[model samples]
Target: MTSSLSLTKKLVNVAMGRESADMVIRDGVWVSVQSGEFIPNTDIAIVDGHIAYVGGDASHTIAQDTKIIDAGGKYLVPGLLDGHMHVESGMVTVTEFVRTVAKRGTTGIFIDPHEIANVFGLKGVKLMVDEAAGQPIHVWVQMPSCVPSAPGFETPGAEITPDDVAEAMTWPGIIGLGEVMDFPGVFNAGEKMMAEIAAARDAGKVIGGHYPNLNLGTIFHGYVAAGIEDDHEGTRVEDAIARVRQGMKAMLRYGSGWLDVEGQVDAILKHKLDSRRFILCTDDSHAGTLTQDGHMDRVLRHAIDAGLPPLTALQMMTINTAEHFGLTREMGMIAPGRWADVLLVEDLNDFHPETVIAKGQVIAQKGKITIDLPSVDYPVWARDSVKLGHPLKAEDFALKTEATVGTPSAPLRAQASVTANVIGVIENQAPTKHLKLEVAVEDGEVSLPLAGGKEGGADIAKLALVERHKATGDVTVGLVSGFGFSEKCGIASTVAHDSHHMLVTGTSEEDMAIAANKLAEVGGGQVVVKDGKVIGLVELEIAGLMSTEEASIVAQKATTVLGGFKACGCTLSNPNMQLSLLALVVIPELRISDMGLVDVINFELIPVIETGK
Candidate 1:
């Protein structure tokens, strides 16, 4: 093992032409992200996995054993970095996620494992940290600040406390605290939230922020004053401007479902704010997106299409992201003393890497991985997480109502129509609309065809949250619209956000029960059932949030699940991604949990049926 002092000395020797460098790449246009310049005919020298020299020529550092590669005048750009993301969102493990993205030139990532933390607690986070350590590229973990996302609003399988945050701060590879999603808790002076923030501050680490509220008033100022550093939830120009004005970096994200960069990039292009304070990331990309499209490369291309200069977009994903995490000396630039993480691309607009190098090693060339990635052997407990008390029946998903519609003394007829609150899903965005629609009541129960008939009708479906963490036979039922399901099918997913409960939605009650039970039988995964038969499934054996299968295979299986949504007549883009967030109670306006239906705007529980109306 080479010591850091010895490595520095060797790097100095190679730079001074006293020793042969391990590798040399000659005659490339250097995309200097630090200075935002494009210099021609630049050559780079690497020794001991660190860059030694980058100047006019590196011929003196080359020896008989030095491996030399001709760049052929391609643009030498720094490897891309995703400053904020979640590995679980891809439905793959850390190793598999890296295998898919590293070939696409994503050399570094900052992941928040709060999704698994909700199910397995701190032990689960340790599992991710251990897996991240073995990856070829940089994978940093942020201690999940909110396990349940919002206390009293929902109950999680496991809970993370301030003590857990402080303990994780001492662990290796922990960059900072995860997104402080409890914005209300921060401004309202909640004890647990404050203590968690204090833990990251005491450890001198970065603290991520998540402020979804659009109102940039006193509450927003209060949230910023709580020492939150950066946020990726901003979806507007004003949102980006306000965050940077408050001394927080604004992360513009372009994921499979959320395409927020087009709206937020105007903060720099239109408002003329400094681009250094803006970073690019993919908050929640599914396996289909990673395998089919790309990772950070996709974000970079999208950012450029949003009217940003090629160099400006590249800087946002590379140097800007690195500087935000205080890792400039280690990675994120094509300069001396930094890791040799470089990408050779022919076209800046397309942003496809012709050659990918990390730590002075050629890992990929021409869109294929040159080396093999080792498989991870997850423990038995992690594989077997979904535990339903018993097989669910159709009755469990029944939305029963009281016999009286109005006051008991002045009760209406038994078959009268009543107003019901519905959780509405918006396309390509995180926030859902709280919809109110009138539905007919028969025999003290609200059934399907709540408003209109099946085809091109109300577009309403039954949403059920089955508590799988504990063997508690609790299934909270609610109503949701905007899925536009026109068939008699049900979709079930164990990848519910923040709290990994089993969320099932369908037009048929029996199919909903079948979908839920099928996932429990397979440990955990996303399953689609139609007319009592399983049509598509992707088994996530690890933590019920990710699969150990290769990313391509998982993406193939997940694609079928997306097709299942289309077959069920749902037309939303990335419907499965939207389905997964229906239970995220922290985001407005309405969501479901194991306890009951949540009104997130008010942080209270209201009846699915408006009582005494």
Candidate 2:
């Protein structure tokens, strides 16, 4: 390791109780997350991207070129950190993600690129890592351990075995293994998953956990025994308590539809559980949510409102997350030798980031990005993620039904195959519902009703999994609810959970086909279709999951799409987010995969309709 002299010298001065620093902020209330206390009248001096001095009045000693900033009684807190998230889920590239989160006081993130890993494997992980290395913020990556998410369950575009995890351990900027989404495999002690966890343990790195089920008995015990360190999928208060009691950090998340923070925090407030083992995360936020609302700042505010003390909530989003990822010495504090990732907030309740600095570099101020972020280019292999093996026609989406020719006069009971386990959309949570709906058969085939409120309207809704990666020309069909999109409108996104395939939802097959093709034509992205025409599109060409363009540009485009959804009578909160996650098989109840519909409860493929009806 190169012994950097600048920061070291500054730290030596601070250790001697002197402030020989390049930058100093005097007269601030330091919200010291380290000890969960606020130190009044503190001065934080910075030199070479690390804190040098953090105590009373440092005006006595300053370098000639040292820049001085007056905190002016503002509350200085450690910049927030996200414990578990996917940069691709924001539909913005790493540069854009950093720019967006920095405005919300998020100085660091531990991202799991499992979405891209499912499609492009290790190379995809490297693409995100390289881009992360370029940002001013701390954007640490985790090697995706469970690609295909569940072996023999779904067919991903790519497969990453334990060998892949070992190979990625050598990559620079890789902190640990990604979320072990294959919890069933772990519970069963599958050789491959166990080997991957073993490799991560051997590398002396963190292994992220994602056991979404509530069976916290032998199965959960098996998972904890398997060496997973942290979990962000806890929905219930008991789930949070169990994870923490088992020595795993419980990451309470508040994303687009996952309102898990309130329930989990109640566990701490009521049961008096250990709050230090908890962290905050936004598992999957859209571009619109990032720009219009905030990131971890929103999570902190929500947690505080949920009865968590302000300082305690801050620690969960800062120091606790930092310590969990083994980056305590590098960040998560305003102490000597820690990176000067600080946020100046006017109100602790609102948690608005007035000014933000990452690694001693001013990145955002007053909700504006000040730094010039570089655009990371995508390779050719990543460009052609959208694939359609065949041209989609209305006939292609038609469900064939057996003719009742001989039994026309007899009592006719048509057998319709509605791929069961409709992935239920839970608001603000990662898990889906296990719902089953049956559709009627018409004219010798199972078919959905038209836009004019036909006979089978209640039983029919269109769900399409457009093959955006590799031009396989495939569109897996299923049905969804809770969107309430009541017109000839379709929402398509490259943000399909885990696999990053194109997920399109429409009442009309023609409109769905048009929207899917439009996204594919743009390389990969999200598009809104109404009346068989494209109204809005957000091009995420970087990896079929994020736009390399500026965050503002992506936000603007996403806003238009949201408006289109509203015009199409979509009443769901963040309609596109609800649509994109319909394919995530890892979460419970029901989900559609590239292969077919998945019963997450059984961890198997189940028919959309029961047989012998």
Candidate 3:
């Protein structure tokens, strides 16, 4: 850790001309994120990785030994911060993710490795922390609070208890508790959940929230009173306003799929609310988006185009995020006594960092990384984690329904309708709609949409959750709509949210089995198969949620994965993201898990087939 005391002494000496600075960035236009003002022709003096002077004419603190960078009056802003994100969701390891996004000017990231934690528990989180500790940029970790996300709704590979959270708080690089995914548990004061929150409070750390529920009733009040300081789950302007009004930081997100900045930015533009209480984040980004597009840079451009002033957008990414996390003095500015992480950008609106400096060294410039980032390796246990109990066959995905309730019969007598629950997906948002439909029962089985009949389906298909944590050989099936898929295709992945179980959704039973077995055969990853032919695949070697592959390779495979989803007749912009969230029991209204279909609003598991149909 960098010592503030030692840094202060060195910066004081450098500014007083008692000693030479380590580096001097001369003649730069400083975009002061702290004051929302621009200072032209500013010379920033740095000593021991801390800013010493910020005014012009720093020749007095410079020597031949000091490295000097001429910024040439370009806007030097603080390097960006990804306030809330998951490194595992990028399908890359922590080291790989940092190397990929750092060149695009992301100097700091607050990551929640809950996906890996769901698969490997505390050991997985420790592996991420160890890797993050060696990175060049600030990679703060929020300990995974809920391994199963919502208990009784799904089964995870491992479980995290309040004791686990209390122990992790003492670890280095731990920023706070991860997004409390169990919103219902917190609001209702579930003993274990509240104990975990109490541990973070006792340790004086922040508690990130994942309250995607739109209920502004007593539940929302109870949640806010229980102490959720920052939330990145808002998808509308009203949701953003509610968070800020309740003394919480509203983190308007623009992830790969959840494109929320456009809607929530309206809170500031139309409602004219204080922008200080709002922060911008990419809660999740796949490898392709992180490599091809940008991290916070992509978000900032969208925020600016959404009618936010350029400076206000920067504040959301830098200062607002830092203040909410209580790290203002250490970062979020180009001022003295702060880390010397500054970006020399060509245009504030375009917002690409042409020259990036972190800790007084120019690390990246012109879309290329200059620093040497050594490859970090994980142990053998980190890989080879896909465990399907037995070889899966086409029969596993078959949702059997008998004439008698609670009993399943195959090869049915035709001409019967059964009541079933379907996961209705909401586009450009996280929540799903729980729809109760009267489905056709043919040959004693709940007929899929593909099986043509007079009942005429809801355009929904079969959804299955394969237990991968243990050799459980458990496959729980449900129904879902909104993919608009209309082919004999299926997509499978082990990246299911929070629980990280194997999820497969398809119209054809044959293709669903093919996709699921393919993932198990390759340990774990994502696959799309149409008519027993594999089309798209991306291998995640670490905990079945991340890859140790180079960023370019992973991004290429991710692109292919998205292409495959399109080939399978999916029209959602990011279907893979949708597929991953199918098992996320935290958000409403319905999701499928290893246990069964979950009604997330009620925080309980519901039978796939409604009784007495």
Candidate 4:
């Protein structure tokens, strides 16, 4: 490593004003992502965190200690880059996130810390930026433009104004403004929202866009004319074509549940649009997907399967993304004066990165990370986030109604929309169903609250959102179905996305209360309880969202938690996914936010109604 650092000195001696290199890889095929072509029998040289040579053999100009890596007929491609993502979505710290993704040959990421920003404000974005700068790979963070995501529609812990964007642009790793999630505000010409976009422009930084609607008339054109550069909200071919035609790079993502690549790849396959205007990203993926599947590597495979050529897939992840972010000169190729980031893959179609290097350092070899990273410390404020106003009781969730005064026996009934708008769980899609279900009323409410099984008991369950941000002492109560939680068990998590609110779901209110208190006792984390006994707990003290713990340690704890859910008969793909989306108010069909039950399609708060009256 010391010799590699000194390599830059040797390169400067060779050519002060010219592009040269210190370390070079001989006998390799370069997957040129810029032109969607592969240059065979090529050599790439690197110096000073930039590529200095990309031609034939460079064995003649080697220094005494200049390290040489023989690609040995393998394909050399620029390291992968994710166009849009959230670091906290992995439930791992930024350092851990980098360490985990390095093994998959991910050299760059465009992250939006908006999830954390909505909970902790500027301090959260700063924390992410600091950690990003320290990483061996590139971690470019975007200043969160929208705090509550939707202003006045919802309330966030802190607000980020136009001034926040200007101030954050001065930060070292602040690449640009984050995804402009407030499309409503932007289309409506809200002064505060437009001013933030202006600030980003004044700073000469890129602006990320998030327009999730399918309407392609005036609103879409209005969004592009407002100075947004790239968008990852394209879920259809037309959506991708429209963005690219309007001079916006269309990002195709395939995360844990969001499968968008297959549809948007049509822009290249069918429409024959400029492939240079497309990029690939995993918008939100968990640790399991990162460890087991891959990071950008997974997106690449899916893109290839979606009918895009191998070279086009590589371009979308590397050169295309780098060009969009204005980092092409520094990265995106094995050419001269670029970062020494390369992936050695035996097969181009599968594109499995066997050896990975960043800044002339071997970070991963054969799908294994070789870097050693230490854990960061969590402050007292971050550790202590869960706070309930008061101990929750069974009656706290009681539904009151007008009862008849003189009836000998009365049916416990109240008026309610029998069929509910259920948030349909699609395996690999972000769009949800506007499902409705009608059921029998119980205790004057439409709750299918179930208790411990085997005996003829109750069929009621409980869902609660504990106030953890400010110790506000609020627990917004609601009902949730389809978890398949049997027996008296409760699942709790502080890693709730977007708001970082405390979400606990259980069959018995007693176990739910116990689990919530346990999470509070540990400052902040995830917990699973059954019959009043602690089943699993993963301590995430940093911002009540992530633990500065080692990825392996956190993953191990999370595995145990999943096992706990299985013990209670919970069987969903990543059962925690269901828990996380419960509080997300952006994606529609149906959802529950901190404000109340939300009809996400209409963006309105709906009341949790009682049974038939």
Candidate 5:
């Protein structure tokens, strides 16, 4: 199962009748992604985890010991591959994610452990790699290149240095460098970023890219020149065309909150770019999406609904992704001498797999995994990562006025109205808006205009980013609008993107403090509080990013959290996803970091108070 040459010899022996075939799939209409046609009456013979023959008939290789499966003339397509994704984002362990998605017509995935890397560094990544290696399905790992994501912007729980990248290049499961989140470093040729890229290049691994809300001209070309290959940050048709035009594979993602596929698929339907250059991925899907609707299967169906041909979408999820990572010879199509990774679906357009085979073994049927997963245990050091330097109190989240702009003679700071910069949240998107609102300065403190703000009015809650890594007890506070809340409620999480700090938003400072301290007391996880009472909590004991709980259990807990959000009078499809990205300094508009408010576009720290300078 490791080497192609080893499996090829066994396949040849089976075809020559020197060895008995282990499995044979009979009478299947081959969904030939290789030829772009469905060839009828295709029979596949497999032996020792490799396909021996794929033709009209395979009676020659059949033996008394061979296990036979009658496909009933169904379309046999290649197993789906999630080109780019993060297992930790599912809020479940690696095993839990595979167990949930395998039955949904997805048999392979390429995972980046950057979320864990930001929490526990190399040791955390090794835990995920080891777990992925033991899964029944095909799981590949990518070395997280940017642990802090953007240096000088925020402090992460851990740091991945060049030496770490070089060592990871030699690991058994490392695929390539994970998405280069440090776009500033790549464009400016930072030494650390360049050394990490050089290590991946020397190891002959593919490099992944992350370019969110970027200009699509020379800067994009500069990033391509730095050896980055593919990107999944595209959310529009023009974004798709931009990446393909630059000779980089454009990864159109359809995660839980990210709805980029519908808008970007027009590049192929209307713009008519080479379909080969487009790929489908789920960069960050949550557990509820996988357990309820589907995984890559859902992505494919949505693509077709958006006017992409069924076969074309399948190609993007299968062969295009496989070829991009140099894994075409191993798993892309249902061809001779390749791994027996096939999905028998009743219909091509609907894409519901009745059976799934991984490495010549039937692992899932319908929507349930039949095989057992690996028994991997995380070390004790991986847990208890939420180190709050001191006990957080309600007063810590208060935003006090420093100096106000008023008359030169009667300069009383408390009497002036200060215009404060706020982080504005967008529904179903990653980027936020920088809003300027004038607030009354009372008792030398900038207080929120909570009386006039309601569900439809211009009211905002206080947002706080608590430093949980160094126990420095640095709490940076800012105002953020967009979570339309009419009640006293708050939510907190350690799953903050890239830097993985503790982000809390609340209408009441007391409720926000309660949620934050509750999560800190549980080591690390997510918590929701309504009217100063705990409503929902999910304990992600592993690095504060992932839970060892079963996928269904975590989904149930998450559902309760969503209910709490609704009860608090805030109604967004995926408010947690929007809340989690508030600390992601890489995205555009404005974000909160440990250093203070960050203007992501300018890549500098701006004062929360406008000062009108």
Candidate 6:
């Protein structure tokens, strides 16, 4: 039970040479994020897990028992921080996500578990908060502000009200209300959304913002007036400029699927806006990306390649993020009174950490974790979240039509072409296209093009949203394009964004049924079925969103799922991530949920087929 006063006293003593430090790193080129300069031949000393002294030589504070680390003239930068992210998107639990990213120089993360919050409500957020507290690095939790994201568009397993937000504000590790995604609710003065924002403001917490609407008119101005502090949903340079102009931090994200940094970083690079108001984050990263590539380190490399100076890019992920969260005195830079989190890198251009230290202890070396992370034991109820009323069949995914020309007893089928409203997927982006395509009808149901039709042929496939929460046996079926599935394959996942329902999309209804049933049997996860055979699977038994298995194992299994998509002729990169978002009804212009197809531009339910037009 060390008090803050006592810790400060110890740090002061070590700085004044009255006490010795626990660890010392000598002779390093310090990348000073505070002054945005690189100082040569600097040393940092740590005491009681806090930086006590940082300047020239610290021989006076060093003792024989103090562990010494020779940086060998390496660039000593602050440990990276991801200001906004979702741990469930990695398909692994918090502990596993930490194990994979901590070694890659990410010492702190701000996680909004809205994905799990939609499933288990506040209890799920508490689960993530408790798990976050045991990590060696700093992990802050944000109370999910949007449960279903958009009300009346989708039904979640649980709902989070303003009462939940006020109650969570009193709990430890809750930094702020997680991204107020309901821009309509905010600008429209919706009571529930206003109350949530009021609770966070009364508690003196930061209010996260998510204004995906590209219109920077009166609506955007009203949204900014609701006391939102930051936004990460911006994709255009103008979007970045508008956010910064409204005194909001513009967070440029580079995720596993969404590559938005290159498109938005020019706000600082070309428009010459102040870089301090801009932050870097990964809104969602998959398990395979964390295991194979890197985490914040990858974003750093990408930012640098986008023509940002190394120190400027490092500032965006470090001090800029810390200041945005009101944690400047806590853990952002290599300064006195801050936590001793630092990274030693030999090259700034490539940005690979040779040694990673957090809270005055060496945790990883050369892209591998050396410290033992604590394992979490999830409750039994979380493991049993996938509750289906009954087993699914091919008929469950059928889209029936009433265009029959004869009676039921002697039904005569007409080869009629109907104008169908399809959810079109744009690669590496969150927004989808509302496409109207003509498709052939057969046997009173919508017919799909045969497998291996041709290169660049029709990519329409059946998309179904099966309710798995209370098991109402409701399956809303629709049509989607841009998966490019040219085989008898189906892909099902319980990792549907915002609601966490079951999403099954494929060319074959029989294979779609198989994929959906397989996930229910294994509890929850993503699975691929090709040619009536199970091709790949990753079992996520925790809250139906994250796996208890190690991240490497999950990554390996997820790789096979990606390979399965390639075998099915879907050439989109990170298609599983795209598949998961098919149920996210927040983004424009179209999406699918358990209710029906959503026209996000109008924020209403539209028919699968265009009738009047």
The TM-score, computed over Cα atoms with residue i paired to residue i, of candidate 5 is 0.97
Pick the winner on lDDT between candidates 4 and 5.
5
**Candidate 6 local lDDT, 289-348, one digit each (tens):** 998889999999999999999999999999999999999999888899999999999999
lDDT of 2 at 570: 70
* lDDT assessment of candidate 1: 0.92
What is the C-alpha lDDT profile of model 1 across 493-524, one tens digit per residue?
99999798999999889999999999998889
Error of 1 at 584 (Å): 0.4
Q: List the residue pairs that clash in candidate 1.
A: none
User: Where does candidate 6 have its weakest 10-residue lDDT segment?
Assistant: 403-412
TM-score of each: 0.98, 0.94, 0.96, 0.90, 0.97, 0.98
* Backbone-clash count (model 5): 0
Candidate 6 is scored at a TM of 0.98
Question: Residues 1-613, candidate 2, lDDT per residue (tens digit)?
Answer: 3267855876877546576677788889999888878888988877777887788977754767778888889999998999898888788888888888888899999899988888888888888889889888889999998888877767778889888899889888999998998998898999999999999999999999998888999989999999889898888889999998999999898986678888778778999988888888988888778887889998888888898999999989888999998899999888888999988889999889888988887788898889888866577877777777655676555545443433346444564433333555665556667776656666545565543343425524678776666677776777776666657677788888877677877777777778877876787778888997888888888667777777778889988888887777676677777777777788888888778788888888875554443
Predictions in order: lDDT: 0.92, 0.80, 0.87, 0.76, 0.88, 0.92
For residues 1-613, what per-residue lDDT tens digits would candidate 5 score against the true structure?
A: 4576777677888887788789999999998887788899999999877788898988888889899999999999999999999999999999999999988878889999999999889988998999999888899999999978889998998899999999999999788999998888898899999999999999999999998865877777778889898999988888899888878899999999999998888899888898989899999998889888889999999999989889999999998999999998888898987789999999988989999999889999887788988877778888878988888889988888665465545455556677888899999888899898776667777666453345333568888999998899989998888887777787899989979989998877899999999988988888889878999888888888888888889889888888887777788899888889999998888999988999998899998877632
Pairs in steric clash, model 6: none
Error of 5 at 3 (Å): 6.5
Best by TM-score: 1
